[model samples]
Target: MDPIDPVHGTATLLLIAAAAVVVLLFLIIKVKLHAFIALVLISVVTAVAAGIPIADIPTALTTGFGSTLASVALLVGFGVMLGRLLEVTGGAQVLADTLVNRFGEKRAPLALGVAALIFGLPIFFDAGLVVFLPIILTVARRFGGSLLFYALPAAGAFAAMHALVPPHPGPVAAGTLLGGDIGVILLVNLPIALIAWYVGVYRMSKVLGRRFDVGLPSLLFGEENDGTGSSGDTDTKTQAPPTFGLVLGLLMIPLVLIGFNTVLSTLIESGTIAEGNILVDGLILLGNTPVALLITVLAAIALLGTRGGRTLGETQQLLDSSLGPICSIVLITGAGGMFGGVLQISGIGDALTTSLGGLGIPLLLQAFLIATALRVAQGSATVALTTAAGLIASQAADLSNVQIALLVTAIAAGATVLSHVNDSGFWLVSRFFGMDEQTTLKTWTVMETTLGLSAFAVAAALYPLVS
Candidate 1:
């Protein structure tokens, strides 16, 4: 039998949910506990408090965690492995160097940001940042300026893409739960996403970078090593880098494949092609995000790893090593889903939204605000987005495809806001850039808020036309 929430009142359940979030924040940031542990603890406590039967609590937790992981874990694992191969094989440097040269020294930050935007398409924010860290450091060392000038643009690009675009967990999960068409969401949001990148990230990074003249760290790129054991190796200094064309082709593979999927599905939907044809089925299969990424990874292993002179054993080792760091990320994301699931089963989202629904706010704005609140409260963008989508999904059923896509963009915008002590991305940026907590708040936090708010503004402005 399915378990039911024991709580009788919506108001009471909402309060319990709020208290659970507070405890979660306290445990993680104030008490210095691990996030995965904290999220699991809160999920269980909140479940019990919401009157979930003792016998069903375990099922509730696992269902949430497993469902999230089912979608997230494979994509993250494959994406990171692909990125690691590129990074280690010098493919990333080739792309970075080519873009910087073409864009000129004065536009170095723009070049890096552009490269990041492309790289960010298939990769998650954290993995993309980690992969790009060495290049960011190398450029800063050569150019002799504050790392922020070089770093923020790239960071913001990844952040923007991750939040707004699909195949990234945040938007994908949000779209899935909201009943938004993934292809339509990707197509409709592309222009807005680019504009958001330019307005929120590209232009703003320069101002913030100049305002905060932070220094580059001494051993920041230590993880990036040459085959000869020297740390912080680059193409120009030692070996022949992979050709820019080759690197670019590799990066474009996933994008093209995924885009093909989007286009083919659209064609099928419009009755341009028979839906059940074998060729159509095969094309769609290849276009699946995870499958596309998997193909890209195998291609990278052969071209980048094997052709680049690494043995099979060495390539295997690199892929294995990449998985270790991401285990924590995967676990925390799953736990966040678990927490969101608990809130869902207890009817907190429905209860809270019903109370807020009477405020007569537009559904677009409502989505953005609810997502923003969840983001600030929980510090996990995927959880905030998925939870917010769940809350508003029923109400949004009558909206058009374009409207649903815009709503997804707004929710993504809200999910991107206010990185602080509670957010893991904040610390990752802080540590990598060698900024103290206060400086991180000033620079990274400010960049994030700007990115979120600008995207929200653009999405809000475009809502009228779509509606």
Candidate 2:
């Protein structure tokens, strides 16, 4: 539907801005340009293209950059460090091994799937993949199974949590930005995610199994080498896995604290922060994701460092190495924020949202479609999500809590569709699964598309219920 309103101009401007984002992502990822630099370059391009006054454009850019970085920088940075510590200590593998031992053979895929669901509850998707990949590989080998079986289930489990759960960064970030309840998001999304994963980890994987052969694909990066006990990878030891207490405690601290604070703030009758509840206060403080992750990083440093008899220098080195690749991601995402913020402030989003009015589609579907188009083009789910959220945030006031939760999931699913050469996740999975680029495109990428569309299909199914 077309509208003959002033926002029509704004709508066009935003469509251009959104398209610029995907183009920018494509250039960076497919053209081998660095994402960080590409994002900055694109932000400037968007500013000029939006016809933002020269005087205000720079400020808009700076404000967007600063605000966006402040929102997610700490969580992403600390999360990177935490995942690194976990990986280097063999903690991720140890956990999977322990779980498989407990769950046994008849249902190994189920066991790995469950491991991903639980472990993914507290970590970012990329970080989770890097840490858990080793264990997944090990399990695949142990069960005499195809990599597709274990990897698909594991990916399904992880994807479900990443898309639907809270205290993990995506939903939490969406919640904080929109003033939605982290607790309610967790409560609401748990069932949706569980329901989705039931379809994904179990049924979806099996359904798609014939199309994808298992075992590490030969074309996977460095797959032929096997790189055992390398200095970069986890080293095996006679020692037990990192203490269950340490692992479980690190994972739960953020959830419990964040949940506690959310409840206390929502339910507490007294206006003032109680003076004697220092422990709860502390938990709440620890629960602020960045702080919680920092604490987890500290926990890993202490437990993993001492247990492995690593020196302080070595410990720091491990942490640093873990974060090496993430710096670009954080910065690129920040640039994306700047790009998103500019569109919002420039009144472009308002124009677009208004244009979509009276289209007779559910707002959630609108959100998903816009996000999916961007994702299918660029392959960066983060950009797809941030861009879509920035646009939809314009219409947020009109939505209910259930609707907001659905929108968040919708945005996530949209961002996940059609991983092409441009998406890092494609390459990561491609390399991990040992597919050549084409095969990776054929299988791993298609799986992601399946995930993105199916999640929305379920979300759409639930819309009438919510309405």
Best by TM-score: 1
In the order shown, the candidates' Cα RMSDs to the true structure are 5.2, 6.5
Evaluate model 2: give its lDDT.
0.63
Residue pairs with backbone atoms closer than 3 Å in model 1 (clashes): none
What's the TM-score of each model vs. the native?
0.74, 0.67
What alpha-carbon RMSD in Å does predicted model 2 have with respect to the real structure?
6.5
Query: What is the model-wide C-alpha lDDT for candidate 1?
Result: 0.75
Query: Model 2: residues >4 Å from true position, as ranges?
Result: 1-11, 18-22, 71-73, 104-109, 119-189, 200-280, 361-449, 459-467
Q: How many angstroms is residue 254 displaced in model 2 relative to the true structure, after the best TM-score fit?
A: 4.3
Across 16-40, the per-residue lDDT of candidate 2 in tens digits comes to: 7667856865776478676567767
Candidate 1: tens digits of C-alpha lDDT, residues 1-467: 24374466877876787778678767876787887888789889988898888888999889778877776677768767776666666676666667778999899898888888887776567656765765676666557667798999999998888888976667777887777788888887777878888887788888887788887664333353333323453322244667878877876777777667766765675467887888878888997877887898898888877654567887787678767776766777677667767766666655655666567788888998888766765466777789889888998888888888999999999889887644556656765577765687788888888888888898888889867
Lowest-scoring 10 consecutive residues by lDDT in candidate 1? Answer: 228-237
Question: Candidate 1: deviation at residue 349, Å?
Answer: 1.9
**How many pairs of residues collide in each model?**
0, 2
